[model samples]
Target chain A: MADAEAKERRILVAVDEGEESMYALSWCLKNLICESSKDTLILLYVKPPRVVYTALDGTGYMFSSDIITTMEKYSNDVAGCVIEKAKTLCRDLQNVKVETKVEHGDPRDVICEMTGKLGADMLVMGSHGYGLIKRAFLGSVSNHCAQNASCPVLIVKRPKSTAGSN
Target chain B: MADAEAKERRILVAVDEGEESMYALSWCLKNLICESSKDTLILLYVKPPRVVYTALDGTGYMFSSDIITTMEKYSNDVAGCVIEKAKTLCRDLQNVKVETKVEHGDPRDVICEMTGKLGADMLVMGSHGYGLIKRAFLGSVSNHCAQNASCPVLIVKRPKSTAGSN
Candidate 1:
């Protein structure tokens, strides 16, 4: 722990096109970033892998190269948009270097790998607050990362306004 | 989020005899507690429920009243010692209100209930870092709290120096 205090900490935050992620980034900025410490905040947006459609696999849907290029472009634009929104949340950060990254892969795998590859001291993400059945069906990204990440993981759960709300 | 910024935050930290928990408290003190914000740090220790042995056609294990009393006293002492150690860790905290609580129940249930009952904005605890088989045998308290606690949960995982180290 003494050594932990002396070195610069790389805090990797996984972001996405969801309000939950933005809320997490905002919470991180407000709570974790110390004014005196040298902290690097890495905002990572993992794009879902592109669909590979073979000629024999499709029933009715056919994709031309132009359409595929358009879809890839849209994915890139979404990643850029999400990163921009996350950056806006960190506008007031002081003594913290903010960096952004966009990677193409499954989020759970990529996030856990990046934490180890980049020597992250901490990983921050948001909980979707899904119900038991929904979480079982969709599989929680934050939960997976919390279990698998090499570094400490901080899960920022957004408070639900009402019991009936998601 | 603006309202959250304006109000004081209640952070509940669960501690035990394990070094993992103390590491979590230290990490929370270093990373989460802001100098300028009004934060209430609640240190909670949960004692396991006393074993109730019924006189049935079972194994030959009996507990005398004196033994039960001594066991209860030991439990009390451990709780006090752990809480005191956690308090010493927070001795240097400024602009933060520190409170201690000792409750009798399972750690997972007691910790989650306390967070909601105390209106905690966040819950901090340590990960045991159990492997799959060990975790199956002994359920993870941090994982349970992370799923059930109403507030955000920050699990501090102590870094293992060697790959073979636990």
Candidate 2:
């Protein structure tokens, strides 16, 4: 039992375009990943659901399919870019397997669901460090995941000293 | 810079008499601590503040100093026992420095303050898995520390399957 417990672990890390998540990935690499273990690092990026706008909602113009396609392409491009950046950060990892996953949904729900569906031993994500009012308004993904995730959740908050410098 | 980043880290773990905290400590030991790094694990146990009683409106009876002294001694003994149990869990750890500290106060404030004072790189604790109503009434210590701690917070939740079996 001890050997199985200390063997391979699947660590799911939620990443996004924000520097905070990138910092979390870096932090996990530095602090959590052990050189002797065969750890699988799953980098998950959740894209916001596509908005369906209708002409009846006071907008005088009808949206074209071309425009919707362009917006979706932009979202995909952003996801690809973020995943590429995250992959670059993992270039130096040894004895670890890195996988990338991109999904579309509310980040809070998607991240939590993915943690369970993926059978992750642990979930690592970054905290936005939003103040009370802002967090109430915008809703914190990390907080929601921390409460709902089945596995242990690691919420990495970037220090204030390096928040702006990075 | 890379060497410095991969060097020693101070990890502060808040523990108590509950089984949940022992699970978190064991989880941290299995997943977070690396054999090659010089990680210092600080085990902190916070004893709830003693309640003060007054005869002005409560039970119309005055409490004796002996009772208060006995209560204080019991609290100290509980703290000592908890720390001793935590240390036992770390007995197999190698290349890791384990330190124990006991403080008296509300756990939320003490754990957060100690993380800052101790300059911890990460703060780990267990989630009580309280329901919405219970959490609203009891005020979760892990949730508060996750919000207020200066460092990253890892909230470990025991799997429901093994929660009762242990």
Q: Considering every candidate listed, which one attains the maximal TM-score? A: 2
TM-scores for chain A over all candidates:
0.82, 0.86
Q: Candidate 1 docking category?
A: acceptable
Give a tens-digit lDDT track for model 2, residues A31-134.
77765677899999887665322322356776688977886888799899999999999998877889999998767778889999999999999887223333
TM-score of 2: 0.84
Question: Pairs clashing in candidate 1?
Answer: none
Q: Report model 1's TM-score to 2 decimal places.
A: 0.77
List runs of model 1 lying over 4 Å from the truth.
Answer: A1-9, A34-38, A51-70, A129-138, A162-166, B1-8, B34-38, B51-67, B129-138, B162-166
- Per-residue accuracy of model 1 over A91-122 as CA lDDT, tens digit each: 87766789998998667788899999988888
What's the distance in Å from true for residue A126, model 2? 0.7
Among all windows of ten consecutive residues in candidate 1 chain B, which has the lowest summed lDDT? Answer: B49-58
Misplaced by over 4 Å in model 2 are A1-6, A51-67, A129-138, B1-6, B51-64, B129-138
Q: What RMSD does each model have against the real structure?
A: 5.1, 4.2
Candidate 2: the clashing residue pairs are: none
lDDT of each: 0.76, 0.80
User: Which is the leading candidate under DockQ?
Assistant: 2
Encode model 1's per-residue lDDT on B1-166: one tens digit a residue. Answer: 2233345889999888877778889888876675556789999988766632122215776777887788789879988999999999999887789999999866777788999999988888878622333334448987777778888788887767633343
